[model samples]
Target: MEFFFYAVPSLMIAGFAAAAYLLVRRARRLRRTWTHGLTAEARCLRMFTTAGGGGGDTSVHTTVHHVYEFTTREGRTVRFEEENGPTTVLEGDFVTVRYLPELPQRATALPPTPGRLAVGTGVGLVFLGIAGSFCVGFILLVHVIFAESDGLLP
Candidate 1:
C-alpha cells in the first residue's frame, strides 16, 4: 500500500513528462521543416489508407496516406507520404512540396493550414501543463509524507 501510494504518482509524472517531451519535439520539427523547407512541384503518385491507433485506453482509427513524388533541381527523384492532406487531392494532381534541400526525402506533400501550427503548439502546451501539474503534485505529496513522518503534519 505504501509502495503504491508513491509509485502511482511517480509513474503518472514520468508518463506525462515523456509525453510532453515527444509532443514538443514533434511540434518544433514540424514548425522548422515548414518554415525553412524549399519548395518544388510534386505529383501525387497514389493514395492508400492505413490502420492506426493508440492502444490500451485510446481509440482505433484509420489514416489516409498520400504518396507524392517530386524531382529535385539536381534531378534526384524523391518520394514521400503524408497522412494529413487535403482530401480533394487525387493521383496525377500537382501539389506544392516542401523539403529541406539537403534532405529531400523528408518532404511534405502539402503545406499545413494556418491553424495546424497553432493546434500543434496548443496540444504541446496542454501536455506540458499536465506534466507540470504532476510534478507539483508529486513534490507536495513527498513533502506531506515526510512531514507526517516527522510529526510536522497533523
Candidate 2:
C-alpha cells in the first residue's frame, strides 16, 4: 500500500516525461524536414478501409488508409502509405507532399498545416494537463490516506 502511493505516481511521472521528450523530439525533426524539404504533387493511389464497429447498422466506425505516389527530382517514383486517422483524402486527389531532398523516401503527403507551431504547443499543453491531473490526484490521495491513519479526519 505504501509503495503503491509513491511508486505509481513516480512511474506515471517518468512515463509522462519520457512521452513529452519524445513528442518534442519528433516535432523538432518534423519542423526541420518541413523547412528544408522539397514539395511535389502526390497522387492518391488507393484507399483501404478498416471497419471496427459491429452493432447492426448502429456503429459505423471506420478508418481509412491512403497510398500516395509521387516523383522525386531525380525522376524516380515512390509510393507510400499514409496513416491519416479518420480523415480520408479521396483516391486520385493530388495533395502537396513534402520530402527530404536527399532522402526522397522520407516523405509525407500531409504537410504540417499552416500553424504547426501553434498546434504543437496546443498538443503539449493537453499532455501537460493530463499529467498534471494525475499528479494532483495522487497527491490528494496520499494526503487523505495519511490524514485518516493519524485520526485527523472525523
Candidate 3:
C-alpha cells in the first residue's frame, strides 16, 4: 500500500511533466518554423457576421462581419477566415503567407517576430508548468485523502 501510494503520485507527476514538455517542444518548433518563413498564398473567399460585446464597459452586443478565404501555398491549402476584424487581404487578391515547414497546413499571412515568439513560448511554458504542477498536486492530494479516509495508510 505504501509503495502504491508513492508510485501513483510519481507516475502522475511524470505524466504531467511529459505532457508539458511535449507542448513546449511543439511551441518551440512552431516558433522556429515561423522564423524560417514557409511559403503560402491566400485569397479572400467571403464575409460573415458574428456577435460580440462592445467596449466602454457598457456591455453592448453588436454584430461584425469579416472576410474569409481559401489559401494555398507550399502544396497545402487552408481556409484563411477572419471574424470581427478587417484583414489586410481582399477578395480575389493573392497574398503570401509564412508557416512552419513541418506543418504546411497552418499558415499565417503576417511575418514572424522572434521577440514575440520568444515571449509567447516563455509564457506558454510557464503556464504549462503551472498546470502540470496543479494536476500532479491534485492527483497526489486525492490519493492521500482517499487513502486516509479508507484507513489504507498506516
Candidate 4:
C-alpha cells in the first residue's frame, strides 16, 4: 500500500515532465520553421488598449496592431492584422512576418530580440503545471482506492 502511494505519484510527475519536454520541443521546431521558411513584409498600423475585470481583479492589456502585406507565388496579394505587445514592437516600423505557405493569413511577427522564446517557455511551464496537477490528483485517487482495498486505510 505504501509502495503504491509512492509509485503512482512518481509516475504521474514523470508523465507530466515528459509532456512538458515534448511541448517545448515542438515549440522549438515551430519557431525554426517560422524563422527559416515563411517570409513576408508588414507594417505596424497602430496601437490599441483594452481593459476588463472578472471575479475580483481588474486588468488592462495593450496590443500593437499590424498589417502584413505579401504576394503569394501565384500572384495574389494578401493582408491581415496581427496583435502583439507594443513593448516588443512599435508602430510605423517595417516588420518581417512568417505565414503558412498555403494559408497566408495565419502568421506571426518575429520579435527582434529572442525574448519571445522566454514567453514560449513560460507558456510551456504553465501548461505543464496544470497537467501535473491533474496527474497528481489522479494518482492520489488511485492510491487511495487501492490502499482501501488492501485494508490499509487509516
* Top model number, TM-score: 1
Least lDDT summed over 10 consecutive residues: which range in candidate 2?
A: 80-89
What clash pairs does model 1 have? none
Distance (Å) between predicted and true CA of 76, model 1? 2.3
TM-score of each: 0.70, 0.64, 0.50, 0.53
TM-score quality measure for candidate 3 = 0.50
Where does candidate 1 stray beyond 4 Å?
1-8, 51-60, 135-139, 142-154
Candidates 3 and 4 compared: the better one by TM-score is 4
What is the lDDT, from 0 to 100, of the residue 147 in candidate 4? 70
Candidates sorted by TM-score, descending order? 1, 2, 4, 3
lDDT of the structure predicted as candidate 1: 0.79
TM-score of 1: 0.70
Instruction: Point to the candidate with the largest lDDT.
Output: 1
How accurate locally, in lDDT, is each candidate?
A: 0.79, 0.76, 0.61, 0.68
For residues 111-154, could you state the per-residue lDDT of candidate 1 as single tens digits?
66647777876877786787768776876887688668884444
Q: lDDT per residue, candidate 4, 58-93, as tens digits?
A: 565444555556665667777777655455566677
Tell me the tens digit of each residue's lDDT in model 3 across 42-152.
Answer: 665665556566667867665544333444444445664434334454566665666665665555554556686678767877876787677677767867887787845
